[model samples]
Target chain A: MPRTALILFAHGARDPEWAEPMRRVCAAVREQAPELRVELAFLESIKPDLRACVESLIAECWERILVVPMFIARGGHLKRDVPLLLEELRQRHPQTCFELAPAIGEAEPIVQAMARHALALASR
Target chain B: MPRTALILFAHGARDPEWAEPMRRVCAAVREQAPELRVELAFLESIKPDLRACVESLIAECWERILVVPMFIARGGHLKRDVPLLLEELRQRHPQTCFELAPAIGEAEPIVQAMARHALALASR
Candidate 1:
């Protein structure tokens, strides 16, 4: 089986604390899928951007890289900027299988969870 | 009884479709809690920014406006920019209570949901 890696791609921010939730989600995924390799990468204002992260993972002989966007929705960044970056990465590494998942927040299950959480917060 | 409103606050994007999930969440919230007034507001590149949303809600006799940030985490935008905007709203409407909820993504339940969703997506 080809070694597969899961990368949690997020829109980074200047505040270091901004990545806390992303890190937590990464940790949770790692815990859930102990057999798989998981990591987090950012778009800007942070270190180890998607390109750099992908390069290192490929260096470790990971044949497949799955990028799961942590964005709240399909904004311009996700629609335009991310695809551009991914295309560049794809061109640079033709052998690697680079897969992109839909933005997690745009998923129906996540939307329903957010709605429930909002109601729970307001009810308190 | 004082009329209370629920405002789903989000970081707006240029693409109108970026708000589709937000609208879905807002509609879900309204469906779950039909008695409460629910709406969506943006920080930029969209109509009815937070200030305008609050103003219109107040006009409709909503004495309390609960702003549930749809942000993924506590970034600089949430820590600094949102607080400044909320402060201005506070000064503008002393009678109306403006309650700012934590970013929905930062909440534990939402994080778990995202983690589960990510794992599911990768598993597929």
Candidate 2:
């Protein structure tokens, strides 16, 4: 059976510490969806860019890949750059199909998670 | 004379890279609220815990302090530990007044940020 892969994309940081939560989030997603193949990639300040991630997914023969951005806001990178890159990749690799989902920030689960964090703060 | 302070809190990591975004967000908040005193504090894997942050605010003689959690989820620390700590601090420092707002994750700006990231990915 063809695999469905989830690529958790983060805004890469040179600091190195910034990546842990993103990794943790990817881990949580895997825990929730054990059968799905989940991976982590970054936009800047690190290796394994989106194209590299996509190529690896293609090698794995994932029929459908969901790229979820682990970003807080769509300022410059998301609004302009990411799409341009994805489009170029799609044109280059016609054999591989890709589906890009909204950043994880837009997901309701994330919002709920934030709310839970808030409530925890308030009760304190 | 009195002032209002914004405390940006994160679940700090030993990795060091995780803290950059929190610092960036705090910087952004400072840029937006230039007059306000914005500070960064961590929950674990670091020094200057939440209580220390609050104490600093008190030392600065701020009349009102806002504690904003930088966490994405309300799992363990935010949900249980933070509130317990805050309560202990409040009991100790009756003179200081604190307003614990929801985590930054719950804010609409964060969601918008995530969406923007997703849009960037799609356009790529």
Root-mean-square deviation of every model: 1.6, 10.0
Can you write out model 2's per-residue Cα lDDT over A5-96, one digit (the tens) per residue? Answer: 76778777666655656656555555555666778888887668888999988887777677787764343566668888888978977766
Instruction: Considering only chain B, report the TM-score of model 2.
Output: 0.87
* Worst window of 10 by summed lDDT in candidate 1 chain B: B115-124
User: In candidate 2, what are the lDDT values of residues B12-89, reduced to their tens digit?
Assistant: 766565455555555555555566677878878766788888887888788766688775434456666888888887
Q: Which candidate is the best by DockQ?
A: 1
Model 2, C-alpha of A62: deviation from truth (Å): 1.4
- TM-scores for all candidates: the values are 0.94, 0.55
Model 1 clash pairs are none
- The CA lDDT at B104 in model 1 is 85
Candidate 1 lDDT tens digits, B19-110: 99999999999999999889899999988898888899989978878999998998777788888888898897899888888888899998
TM-score of chain A of 1: 0.93
